[model samples]
Target: MLLERGVTDAELQAEANRIAVKVESIFSSYLAGSGDGRDRLFEAMRHAGLGGGKRLRPLLTVATGRLFGIAEDRVIRAGAAIEAIHVYSLIHDDLPCMDDDDLRRGKPTVHRAFDESTAVLAGDCFHDLAFEIIADTATHEDPFVRAELVLEMARASGPNGMAGGQMLDLVAEGQVLDMGSITRLQQLKTGALIEFAVEAACIMGRLPPEARTPYRGFARDIGLAFQIADDLLDHAGDEAVAGKRLRKDAHAGKATFVSLLGEDRARQQCSILIGQAIEHLEHHGEEADLLRAVARYVEERDR
Candidate 1:
């Protein structure tokens, strides 16, 4: 069962699950003490943010931070902030005007579970909360570090990043795109925040900008690999296990890595990317075992 460095696939899943639980708790605490007719908004936010996720971005944050001996709790808080942004994006992405998904994580999406307006508000609140958490001293003791986290996270989630990618995706619908265009879209839409997850750790660890090049490279590779795996999953993955409507990309006429590249070739490319990702960590020791395991998990994950 051992994958590498005494880490197993099951162990990676367990850790992801554990991070999910911890993130749920953090979300609960933050959403608590809400009053004054905001209960429904809070409820919708909880429905969107609380349960059922891989928490991969947070895991990357914690794993990379561990390389510098950062306290787990500190990194977990930062990771939770990143998770909030992720949840916010998902909530909006599932709206009627967006992907129009009804199911997510084995249940009705926020818009389906609640109402559209409530879902929009919930997503908005989660976006606000992400920066609030990162800005607070509780996430990091250094004011400079907190500011940097906020700036990087904002950039990752802003127009030049996820939002821009989403726009590109919407525009690409029904249009045939070359591999370069698809790669650019995925890099912005999916890869940016993923890269930020690792970058946040380096920032917290006080690693110089120059020293973060390898980690950045690792993040970029894994981010693309993760999206390719997702496209493959959409191509043929089971809906029941994915807990969401599958084949939406194909149905929407969106060009994905799988759509442009054959499934076999996409899988092969994913393996290559993952290999490159792990090689980026060659300078590190076993302290990076979790990251290596994460890269493998990204390649092998079914959902």
Candidate 2:
């Protein structure tokens, strides 16, 4: 597969390292450049970005941008922004008030690493940086377009999207939910940002309206697919391999794909979603291959 050939462990790690370094450098005003007020911004931003993960969201943004023949530098900037959004989500999710997670990517959660206040503030600052980068492109003729894309991202990440789903999760906690409600919860909580990611690239690249609709559909499917695969991983994968705590879903009594469908059927659903995700890519062929590979990678990866 085109995506399979492109994705490699070394490729991911190298990409993560470079993006982490670049994000810090690009946003260093908080740390290296300015007023005391900015110092806290840099600290929180760095705490999350440099904290470490696979950098999948950033890579997804970049890979999709490449579909339109966008320049590498622009792609890198956009990629870094995506990473910021993702880590920011993680920072908030790991809070004692949220997921209450102590470990993230095998390290202390942001709140644990610094303090609860710092973690909350860090997530907020990262959110600010994401818009800053996207909006800063106003010098370009397409600045309005880029700004719109960022707006879409903000909607997905904010109370209406990720946060909304999280609220539902909290309310539904420890309760038995029907499959439909469970899927809806996952779509909002886990899938919103991912859907925004693919569409963001499409919008930025200025894909034709005809093509953009398909990309939106593709994004929605892959978003749900990846989330289900994550649920599958929670059960079948180990903490050592999953890169964080394992079986936390069952421990927390959250309804997951595995919880509703059982491991075998959940794996079966993963295959179906992966297949559908790839099928969605067929319209764009190689242009969509990287995303196709990403869907496959998400399905196959233990972590």
Best by TM-score, which number? Answer: 1
The parts of candidate 2 lying over 4 Å away from their true place are 1-41, 138-141
Q: lDDT by residue for model 2 over 45-94, one digit each (tens)? A: 66667745766676677667767877656666666676677778888988
Off by over 4 Å in 1: 1-5
RMSD of 1: 1.7
- lDDT against the true structure, per candidate, is 0.90, 0.74
For candidate 1, give the lDDT of residue 114. Answer: 90
lDDT of 1 by residue, 18-132 (tens): 8888888888988874677898888888888877888999999988987888987888888999999999999999999999999999999998899999999999999999998
Best by lDDT: 1
